[model samples]
Target: MNKFDAIVIGAGQAGVPLAKKLAAAGWKTALIEKRAIGGTCINDGCTPTKTMIASARMAYMAGRSDELGIHIPEYRVDFKAIMDRKSTIVKQFREGATKGLEETKNLTVIYGTARFVDPHTLYVDKNDGSFENYTAKKIFINTGCTPFIPDIDGLKEIPYLTSTTLLEIKEVPEHLLIIGAGYIGLEFAQLFRRLGSQVTIVEKSNRLMPKEDDDICTVMSDIFDQDGIRVWTETQVESLSLKLGKVHVKLDGGGKGPASLNCSHVLVASGRTPQTAALGLENTGVVCDEKGFIKVNKRLQTAEQHIYALGDVKGGPAFTHISYNDHLVITENLLNGRHKDISKRMIPYCMFTDPQLGRVGMNESQAKEAGIDYLVASIPMKNVARAIESAETRGLMKAIIDKKSRRILGAAIIGEQGGEIMTVLQMAMMGKITADEIRSGIFAHPLYSESLNNLFMSV
Candidate 1:
């Protein structure tokens, strides 16, 4: 039996930072990970996908260079080279993470799956034949989540890919059928479409990304339609089958009755669920919600006060940045005994399609649903000088301001560097900058951000 001051169940974004902090604070820590060091971000989620997305974006720009007055007669995409580049960068990041863990004093990195025998006792099933039992005063489960596989007929029997599996694909799929139209689906749909694949997206909801405002969703649908991508919303996938080496997908509902489609590959991007079933939390008396998420308070503490849950495992916003923020909260609690709550934090996220959607604070729909007194203002990218000069005018910038406070409530950007432009609004909201300041603010000429001057002026 082994004992440590702290035991972090997963070496994820939250676990890594928390473990380092615990070790630095003179606590003997055990960081247990069943897989590679970097967890979801470096291995499958952010790093590899973004790197491939970059390659796809460059290919798209080269193909459309005629509009920019730089005509390249032909541009060929080497799918293998793109995959290799992704692999190289992923390797570098994983090695760097591994090095950091090694350098952490009093941090014992273990390769194993940990299950709670009791609240304080953990039985570690190591990769090797040897097994160990560990007890700690403080335990954290940052195991995060996995891509949820929806129960469609004949799904498991066929070679369908998840978001993680699709990243490892070397060949550009001849035809890719995505099962969901959320952020994961849209990003891959655009990336593969740009990589010369015939991409079709099917969403179960009535519209694509129903979480966004109706207008924003409509604009995204139009942009994809213009880009030669087929989108079918209010669609339900009935079953999947293999026909002559192609994936034959039978989808029901939508505008069409029952429909059958054939594709070279099928990628499922429905959603993800917390990874807690195998953690043996049942024996620990820690309660998990109906969706399998470990129930954590605003301070990220579980039913067992000594044990904490962070990141997607606690089932709120599932993003790398959110997990990092979870680390900050947990570290502060452990170090200064402070209760820095994450429930009220301003969460910002971006979807990296061609016309990236950068969002911070409340969208129009949310403010309306909450019955908040808000004012909305918008500016089309076509109205911006930089957008016209760059010939990338396709989306819009929208802001929602609280009427009473005259402060920015939320803003959404769907243009080139949409996330980058949204950050300006996020800072304004953070600093309590009023809507009037943004309206009258003098911004530099000929930049997409300068559209802020016009966006708020119209409000």
Candidate 2:
């Protein structure tokens, strides 16, 4: 039996940081991962998807060279080269994470699947078929999540692809059918469409990205229609089957009859579920909701006081940065004996589409739902000099402020560099800065971030 001061299960964004902090604070820490280091963000989810999106965006711009007053003879996408570059990026980040762990003298990295043998004991199943027992004072569960594939008939038999397997393919599909209209689905739809694939998206919701603002969804739907990506809203997928190397999907709608779509390949970009099944939570006192997510308090502590849950497992937003913040709160509570709750932090989320969408704090609808008096201000991208100069003058910047206190309630941006510009709004919301402070701030000339200044000025 091996004993440690802390045991971190899963080496994803949350676990890695927590382990490093504990180890650096002079604790004997043991980090366990069933797969590679850096977790899903570096391996299968964010990093790889963003890299592929960059390649797709470049290809799309090349197709519009005529608009830029540059005549290109011909442009061809070397799919293999793009895949190679993405692989290189993932490998580099993975190696860097591994090296960081190795440098931590007080941290021991274990590559295996860890299950709770008891409240304080963990049984590790090593890749080499050997087993080891570890005991620790506290544990952090950061196993993250996996793509949720629906239980459609014949889906398992078909040679369908997911975000995980699709990233590894060197050849592009002739026709790709995406099964969801959330961020993941829309992102891959745009990417494959730009890569010359006839893409069709089927969403059961009334609109794409239903979680986002209605106006933003309408604008993005228009952009998607202009890009030749077919979107079917309020359409239910009844069945999926393979017919002569092509996948056939049957759909049903409220006012319409049954419809079918035949495609060369199908990609499931539906959302993900928390990866908590194999951790053996039953052995511990920790309780999970019906959806298999760990139930935790605002401080992220599970039913077992010493065992904390973070990231997707704790539910709510599943962004990488949120997981990192979870690590900060947990470390502060453990090391500095500070009392900071996870809910107190301002969480911002972004969808990296062509006209990226970002939101922080409460929006107009949310504020009204909460029965709070709020004021709204909006600025179009065309009004910004930088957006006009970039020749990508589309989308809008919207701000929601508390009418009583003049505090920035929430802000949403959908335009060029909207993702980058959201950081400032997030800072204002988190720091509890007022609208006047933002309005008085001087912004640099001819930059997209200037939209923030213009937004508050109008308010």
Candidate 3:
């Protein structure tokens, strides 16, 4: 039995950093993982997906060279090269994470599946088929969630892909049929479509980004339509089968009596489910919600106060940044004796579509649903001089402001460099910068940042 001051199961975004912090603070820490370090973000989620999104963007731009007044006769997309580059980036990130963990003194890296023998004690089934036991004064679970494979009749018998496996295709699929219309599915739809594949998206909900305001959804839906991406909302994927070399899917709902699609590939991007059942949570006082997310307090402590759960496993807003913030929250409370609650933090997220959807705080609908008095301001990309000059005029910038406090409430920027521009607004919200101050702020000319000045003028 190995005894340590801290045990972090799953060297993910939260676990790795927390382990490093604990070690640096002069505590013996054990960081355990069943797979590669760097978790989903570096290995499969953000890094690889964003690298491929960059390649897809290049493919999209090169194909539009003529529109940009750059004469290009022909250009080709090397699907293999794109995947290779993505793999290269992922490898570098993974290596860096491994090195970081190795350099941390007093931290032990263990490769195995970990199960709670009790609250403070865990049994690790090593990859080498050896068994080991460790007990720590404090334990943290950062085992992030995995893609939830939905049970549609006959779906499993045929070869289908999830978001992770789809990123690995060496060849651009002829026709790509996606199972969901959420962020992951939408990004992949645009990515593969721009990479020269015909794409179709099906959503059980009535609109794109069901959580967004109708107006925002309308704009994005229009953009997707113009891009020639077929969408079927209010639809249910009834079943699936293999026909010849292609996959066939049967669909229902959507007001159409019956619909079916035959595509070279099918991607299931419905959602993700937390990884907990394997951890043997049943053995500990640590309680998980009905949905399997570890129930944590504002400080991220489990029912067993000495144990904490972070990142996707804790369930709300499964962004890598959120997980990193979770590390901060835990480290602050543990080492500094300061409580930094996760609930009050501002979160910004981006969808890597061509006209990226960058969002921070609440939108109009959210504020309205909460019965908060809010005012909104918006402008089209075509009105922005930079967007017009760049010929990437396809989206809008919207800001929602609080009517009572006169502060910036929330913002959604869906245009070229939307995420970058949205960060400026995010910082404003973070600092409690007022709407009037943002409106009067001077910005450099003919840039996306300049649009910020115009976007806030209305409210």
Q: Per-residue lDDT tens digits of candidate 1, residues 346-399?
A: 999999998899999999999999999999999889998899999889999999
Task: Tell me model 3's lDDT, rounded to 2 decimals.
Answer: 0.91
Q: What's the C-alpha lDDT at position 392 in model 2?
A: 82
TM-score of each: 0.98, 0.97, 0.98
Summarize candidate 3's per-residue lDDT along 373-439 as a digit string, tens digits: 8899999888989999999899999989998887888888889999999999999988999988888
| Candidate 2 vs candidate 3, lDDT winner | 3
Please write out the lDDT profile of model 2 over residues 386-421, one tens digit for every residue. Answer: 888877877889989998888888888988888788
Candidate 2's C-alpha runs over 4 A off are: 457-459
**lDDT, each prediction:** 0.91, 0.89, 0.91
Provide the clashing-pair count of each candidate structure: 0, 0, 0
**lDDT ranking from best to worst?**
3, 1, 2
